[model samples]
Structure formats: C-alpha cells, structure tokens
Target: MVIDRRSVQRAALVVLPLVLFVAARAVSAVGDGPLQNGNFEDSPDQSQMSGSVVAGEHAISGWKTSGHIELVCSGQKQGDMVLTVPDGAQALRLGAGASIEQQISGLTQGSYYSLTFAASRTCSQDETLSVTAAPAPSGAGSPAPAQTGELPMQTVYTSIGWDSYSWAFRAEGAGLMSVVITHNCGQEEDPACGPIVDAFAIKALHDQPPDQAAADNNMLRNGGFEEGPYIPPGSPWGVLVPPVDEDPVSPLPGWKVMAYKKSVRYVDSAHFAVPRGARAVELVSGVEAALLQEVDTTVEGSWYRLEFSAGDAANGCASSSDGSSSSGMKLKAYAGTSETTVDIDFRGAGGSNRGKIEFRAAASPTRVVFVSLGYHTKSDNSGTLCGPVVDDVSLVPIPPPYARRLLL
Candidate 1:
C-alpha cells in the first residue's frame, strides 16, 4: 500500500476535476428560472392520495408536502360554492400547518429574486399565506437567514376570486434554495380551511436603485413601469405588489405600495390596455392603494413639476354599451407637502391623458405619491374593483422664471 505514491496523487487530481464538472452539470440541469409543476397541474398517484388529500411528503411531483395538503380541481363544489383554480386546471390547498416547497437552483448570490404566485382565500375571510425562502440544507457554513412574508388574502383585487401576487427577497447564498408556501390560518374547528395557491414563478430582480441612471430626465427609476417581476403567461389579472412596509423589496422596482393592506396592480399591455410602454400600475384599491417613490431634487424648497399619464386600463370599469365608461377616474398626486388631483374621463377604450403638478420640494429628496380617489368596478358586474392606470412618471426642476410666473 505504501508503493506508487506519485500515481495515487495523479489519480486523485484527475478524479477531482471530473467530480466537480459533473456536480456543476447537475446543478445547472435544474433550470432555476421556473418552478417545476408550479401550477399543481401534475396530479399525484392514486396510491398516494386518499380522496383529495395527499398522504406522503413526496407525493406531489416536483415538490415536498407536509401536514394536510389536498389537490383541488377547478370548479370543485363545496356546499353552495365552487372553487376556482387561478392557473391551469388544478391547484393546491394547504390545511393548518401544511406547506408545499421546492428547491430552486441557478440563483446568483447577493442578487434579489421575486416569487410571483396566484392565490385566493378559502373557508374564512381571515386566511393568510406565508411564503419563506432559505438556502437549502448544506454542509457549508450555517446558511443564510430565511426570508418570509405573510400575505393577507382578505382583499380580492381581481374579477376572479384569485389574484396574482409578488413577493421579493435577497439571496444571501448561491446554489440551491428552498421556497415554501404555508397556510398561516390555524382554525382548529376546520383544519382544512386554507388558501388556494397556484402559478408559482420566480424572477431575478435587477438593481434599480433610486439614484440609478434613468432612460430620460425622469428622476425616478423604472418610471415607465418597464422593469418588474415575471407575469405568468396568459394571466389577465396583473400581479399585485404587496405594500412596501410588509415586503420592503417590491417586485416593481423604484416604487413602493404605501398601504399596509393594499396593493398596486402591475398590468401588462397584453392583458390590460397599458398607457405607455408594455406595463403600467392600475390603482385597483381606490384610496387604500397608493404608490410612492422618493427622488433627489436639484435644490431644497425649489419648485418641481411632477408630470404623468393617467387613464383606464380599458378593463371595462363602469363602461356603457355605447362605448364609454359611466364615470371618470381620479388620482391624487403628491409632491413633497403639496398635492393636486387629476381627473381622467373614460372614453370607452384604453387611452391616457397627461397631467402635471408644480410643488416646492421642501427637501432634496421629495416623496411622490399617487392615490386613487374613487372606487370603480368592471362594467360586466363582476364586482371586481378597477381603477386608473398610471405610467410614464417624470419629475424635473422648474426654471425660476416659470416657477415665479406659476406662483404668481
């Protein structure tokens, strides 16, 4: 055994690289962008299921389930209600402490990633869903801290029962990461009560810091609503960005949803009539829904003009058969301490009207906020709240001459 030490060393060197190469290929094979079987359309085997309840942790394809998890079919009847699946023909219902998770690979360390999923409450109005992401079990170091966010499902922002929501977190480590969605509702009387979840997808968010260079003179980043989380294909209802206070990192960069219980709907041109670019934010929650951004100004107390486009997403909000909405939409724009309201009359189709407001900065970084003034619903009588779409936001300093004249 003591002979040929040099041969042994050479063998070790050759085998090490081969092992590393194979390991790298295995990691890349997972294809980190899309979550496998995210829509829950892949049904479990009959042996693994007792009726709709899945028995084992590995029963669901491409996922690990725990506690009481059930596969729900679209239009499944329960008493007088029919369950609606948000994506595809099937969805998952987590009961009590139950959760479903899958490990995603190809993540870049220190980069931000956002999870976009469609969910709706069931059984009780107080139902909430908790989403958490942490580095997968590894022998290296202690692993990064887990990021979690509890979403309140009491508010339904779409005509359908389900709404697509986005949650963001920063990846502290590369390699594989585990993403789990659990039902937070702990109703002992009915352990089956939980939220229906579907359409799980993730998007890597590019850095769009407030001070980042803009495409135009607009001080705000992503002002055109071009950069955002991935929208599940064919999702007519846009993704809802939860309040900034709850999620801190928004899927829609450079902007924050102000209300704790409200969200701003991020719509696409394919789904909703976007005013500008390929995307826009629809203020669907009336006054509860507000978007805010802070941008640096040239000088403190200097006048600045906040210009933006506001219009209907052409979602049939209060529409009449004659081709026009019955009511107009109003948006209140706030620049620093001063504010102004803009009213855009609906003209049946999707279109935008330009509006501007001049206000003193009061400080170098002024807070810009947009709040929908009135409540609106689709003309089809779906009872879904719909409102004006805001896009192409720009803030620039006003010349002294124009400022003085406007002041007078």
Candidate 2:
C-alpha cells in the first residue's frame, strides 16, 4: 500500500519539536548535574555515577577503589541521579552497611547499611534524609525486585564506612547508575548535609601512605607498628591507643601488671593487687607503667627501677614478674639507657617474681630515674618474656621528681 506523503509530513512536524525539546533538556541537565550522583562506595564501581566526568557529550568514568573520590552537579542539587548502567536489576540489600563514620578521640558514630535494591528511574530521601529507594518495593524493608532476565546483578552487602561524606564508598552495576544526594551528619547526622544533595561521589575517601623515613623500619629488627625503638621525648613516640572495647586499669604507684600485644587476657585484670594502702606515688608517665613490677635476678644484678615514667632520658627500667625472680619467669620491662656504668636497678622487691615493669625518662639525661629496689631472687632471664607495658603517654611531675616552683 502506498503511504500518503502529506500525512507523513504532518506527523513529522508534530513529533520533531518534542524530540528536539527532550534532547535539549537532557543535554542541559547533563551540563548542570551533580558530580557524585550515585549510591556507590569508594571501592571499584565509581564510573557508574549518574553525572560522571563528561568530555563534550560523552562521560569519562572508571572503576573506583578505597581512595579519594569526588563528584559534582550543576543545574540543581536536588532530585535523584542515575550513575550506572541501565539494567533490569534490583538494588543491593544492606544488612548492616555503613555509609558514614565519624571518629573523635574515643567516640565513633555512623550508619550500618544492609539495603535491598531494585530497578527504578530515580532514588529519593525523605525530608528527614533517611535514604530510600524509589518505587518502594512490595516488602516494606526488602531489596528491590530483580531485573527480568538480565545479567545477575553484582551484589555488595558489606559493612564499610568513610571518615567523611555519607560512607566510604558507593557502587551500582549492570544498570544506569544513579545517586540521591545527601550531606554529612555531624557524627549524629548533619542536617546541613541535606535540604538538597550537595555533591555525591564514589571517591570521597582516602588514606595517606606511610612516611618514607619509617618505611624501612617495617623490615628492621627495631619496632613493629606501635612497637618500636625507645621513642624519646620531643619525638612522636609509638604508643598503643587502646581500643574502644578495652577497659584500661590503673593501680597504685608501686603496683604493676604484665601484658603484650599478642596477649591481652592476662593484663585485662590485676593479678597481684596493690591493696588499698599500698604506697601509690605519682611517678612520671612513659617511664614506668609496668603491668608486672618485679625484681630481675637473671643478670648478676638484682636491682631494677619502678615501672613507669613519662620521660625517656631518665635512665630507668620497668618490668613485671610472677614475683621477683627472672629465670623461667614472666616479666616485661621498658628499659632505658643505663647511661652510667653503675646500674641503678629498679627492683620488684615486694614480690618474688617481677610480673611487669616500665622504664622511661625525660629527654634530658638527668630527668630519667632508676628507682632501684634492693630485691633479690634466684630466678634468671633464661625464659623471661620481659618487656614494658604501656600506651600513648604524657608526663606529669610529682613531689620529689616534679621540681615545683611557685608561680605568680
């Protein structure tokens, strides 16, 4: 059958402008889109953002990693964006996925995500900023419906977070990627991060590499991460920052305990109590904070120092023991340079086995102390795993060592 030319011409006129208008709008929207419009994390899958880097008309994208990333949008900072391959898959379920994490001193706050995903044109967030996948699924709190006969969606339901932004990463795959913008929730949840999405991206996290000077130290016989050569004053000495789960214990000045990085159960509780009346002196920190404070009998000399000092130059020693004996013993000490030929051995006289010890001194030589105790024991250092027990420390002076001066 022959078609009428005039009818076709008339139809074209009606359809042409609508098509042109739609195309123009899309171009304009791309020009003014958010950079980080995506629901992806900082791992592989960054290039899937809705408004990724564009070159003229095409967008430049790449897989993401656990590093720095950025995203931006133009026209408006509101509305949902697509930033992944358009497909017929559902959103990933977040059992307990973390989107953001804020850590301060000894506190942490963030979200744990375990979301179920679905295929949709857009995503959204309520006024409250609780992110929600658009086209709410049949199940109130379930992932979206999977696409009809498509490549199995790459599912990622992991517990991860970033120091900034919403989370540590964003990702979506086998679908036209998209992201609903949100803001940082100042540890709790930043209202300012909302109202409208600022910039969304998969690359919003980064960690600086280790320093070069200390790079070789990793292989040297010196110290491991946190454990190292005697960190002196004026230097960023190594110290263990207790984990949130740990409950640090404190005892009398003379009381001590024993512990190691590999083992913790022993030091978690005080074995030998430093009774309520035990002489507790305010010894300097960093120098003597031994978990096991006892006398060493292995090395010909029986004298050792109290286990705690804030300074490293106060020639001292710290140790812990079952009692005071060093042979076939359990002791740890933080010993500083004897400096002098005559060792002012700080001894764990009270107990027969020195269970722990810590030695430290101020950067200045004279500041280091060796509170030597004239304790004796038949034990030796043959089987002693002796060292010091401590964490990041600072110094404070007391009566005898404080050298106080009246201030105006």
Candidate 3:
C-alpha cells in the first residue's frame, strides 16, 4: 500500500513541539532584588531590610549574592544598574535604578552575565522584573553564554511596606561574572524612612541534564516522590451505592442477619447504586470462604454486584455446582458496555479478597446501580459466620463510564 505524504507531515507537525520541549532547561536564573543586597554575598534580613525612601536617595538591599545590585524609586524616571554574576550563578538582580557600574574579571579567559533592573513603585501594573545577559560575542573569549529569559515578578512602590523580589540566574561558560541591579527610587518621598527588602535563597538545581529544569523546581530536598499533580483543592470524592452483604460477618448490623450454616451461605440482600466513573468492584471473604463461585452480576436487567459462594472459587467463569465446594459455584462479571457488550470476567483471584475486577461501559450513564453484599461460604469451616463479620460487594465502572463525584 502507498503511504500518504500529507498524513506523515501532519503527524510530524503535531510531534515537532514535543520534540523541541526537550530543551526546556535552557532558561535563565534570578537573584534577590537590590533592596536586599548592596553586594550579593550574605543573606539579607527581610525585617532589617526595610527603610524609608528619601526624595532623591535610593535605598537598596539584597543578600545571597556573589555580586552587587542597586534599588529603584517612584515619582521620577531614572536609569538602571546592571548586576554581574562572575561565574557559577551570576547571583544578581536589580531593584529600581539604571546601569551605573560593572566590573567582571576572568571574562577574557571565560564567560560572564548581568541582570536588568525591575520597574519602580507607582507602576503597580508592573508585576515582575526582567534580566538578560548581553553576550560580548564572536570571539572565544566570551565568559559563558548568557541565559536569555525573563524573571516573572515585579516589586515597585507599595502603600505601606515593601514586597520582596528575586530570581535565579545561571551561566554556562566557566569564568568571572559581572552584574549590577539598576535601581531608581522615586525622587519624592514623604514620611517613610524605610523601604523593606525581603530575603531569598539560592538552592542549586541538580547538575544533571538541563531537560529536568522545570521538574527541578519541585524536587524534594530528600529526593523522594515527584511533586504533586496540582489537583484542585476541591476535587470531590467518588460515589458507590448498594454495598455487599455476607452471612457470618463481623459486626452484624440491626438490618441484616448472621450466616445460617457453616457449609455455604449468602447475605441479607442489599440495594446499591454505581455512580458515574467507577473503576472496579470489591469482594471481601473470610478465611473460611472458598474461592469465589459464580460471582456474576445481578439479574436486575442492567448489571449489579458480583455473587460468590464457598464452592465457586475455581475458574471465575460460569460453572455448575459440583455438590462439593472443591467445584464450588463459579460465576463471572460480564465485562462489556451495556451498549458495547465487551465481555470481561472476574475470578476469585483477580481482586477476590481486596482487589477488584475491571468493568467497562460506553454511554455516560447517570447511574449503573448494583446490589452489593451477596456471597456464600468462604470455606467449609474457615470463614464461617460466627461473630459479627464483614463482606462487601461493589460495582466497578471501567473507563468510558469513569468520572469522579463532587461534594456539595
């Protein structure tokens, strides 16, 4: 058969973005704003980081810096100060100011980087700051290739206190880095004397391939399970009705009776419903309960809970009772879409005790109800109904029919 060229091209077009996503690691880093760091070396105290702004005086602060940064002011327009990160993380970010001075060493033999300043106060609409490393390029003497990305943050003049701003920056070329955070405080300050600067940290992302960069933001300090899936805070629970019933169960309720015989028995009958999106059904047995026999759905038109007795634990298909539980009753769950009719079977082994057998459906029915808790002897004598015991039966909605429930 001849293959269609257009089809192949379309498929490639769909997959091209995914292929390029492999380079997601090629992003830039950020540093605490100048309000906290005068020279990025030590950690800045967010509390002590505060101070009032004078009309023309720029109050800057920052910590965890290997470089220097300046601050910004409101009410007037000013230039910026470019921060320099000599080597590893050119740990440098700016507040409100203009590029004033930059001194980076070892760049002639390696790479270098710098950070741009954030917007000033009164620019409430401005959310974050941006920084880029202008590559002194062409020759091999370029310190490291500068990272090209934006820091998604902003901290201008607030009504009362100050908001902290910081980001992480990275350099590839191994050399001394130069950085300067440009700042321009408003030329007009009224009564405030302290513009607070918050604290920040520089935890290294792994030295592994850059592809893991985004995921690195969420890795645990101890290295365990991956970050959460960001499920909604209010995602609701599931819905299942008409529980299973069994004789000789533990903790007998006022509504149901105990098992009549030790040889084989069933439950007091139950009324249950299967909400949309259920996945699997459960059948619990006592130690005495034999392998599930004839564990089939309810004869109530649509399918219901599975039925099992002491005798039918063998092949969980349809089988006749052989008098002895050795050949105990054998039943099966009809795996099919009420409309699709896909045949699936459940056994004593497939979730016989704690596990569940899968079931499927086609339409998004409002409910696939069931009558849970109907079974027989777990064994000849083992799981006999003595004291209050427990037996369960639940309807498992397979894929298409699967949906979660929401609480009011």
The candidate that wins on lDDT is 1
| Candidate 1: regions farther than 4 A off | 1-33, 186-188, 207-215, 296-298, 319-326, 404-408
- What 10-residue stretch in candidate 1 is worst by lDDT? 317-326
Return the candidate ranking by lDDT, descending: 1, 3, 2
lDDT by residue (tens digit), candidate 3, 49-70: 3332221222222222212242
What C-alpha lDDT values do all the predictions have? 0.81, 0.23, 0.26
Q: Could you tally the backbone clashes for each prediction?
A: 0, 129, 111
> Over all chains combined, what TM-score does candidate 2 have?
0.17
Model 2 per-residue lDDT tens digits across residues 1-408? 999999999999999999998886654332111233233322223454333321121122221221112232223232364332211121111111112211111101121111111211112222222232122223446543321111111111111100011211122222122222222122224222222122222211111124732453221111111211111122111111111112121111112222221111111112211212211121212222223222222222122233222111111223423454342212222333333212223342222222223233333321222222122121243222222222222122223332222111
Model 2's C-alpha root-mean-square deviation from the true structure amounts to 24.3
Q: Which parts of model 3 have CA positions greater than 4 angstroms off? A: 1-124, 133-144, 152-161, 182-201, 207-408
Per-residue lDDT for 1-408 in model 1, tens only? 567989989999999999999998875554324578888888888899999999978988899999888899999976888989987899998898889999887777777788899898777777788889898878878988898887778888766788988988776676578898888884546888788888888888875455555545667778888888888777788888888675567788788888867788888999888878898999888888789998864478688888999887887875332345447778889888888888777743678888788887778778899998877777777777788889988887788998999778
lDDT of 1 at 302: 82
Between candidates 2 and 3, the one scoring higher on lDDT is 3
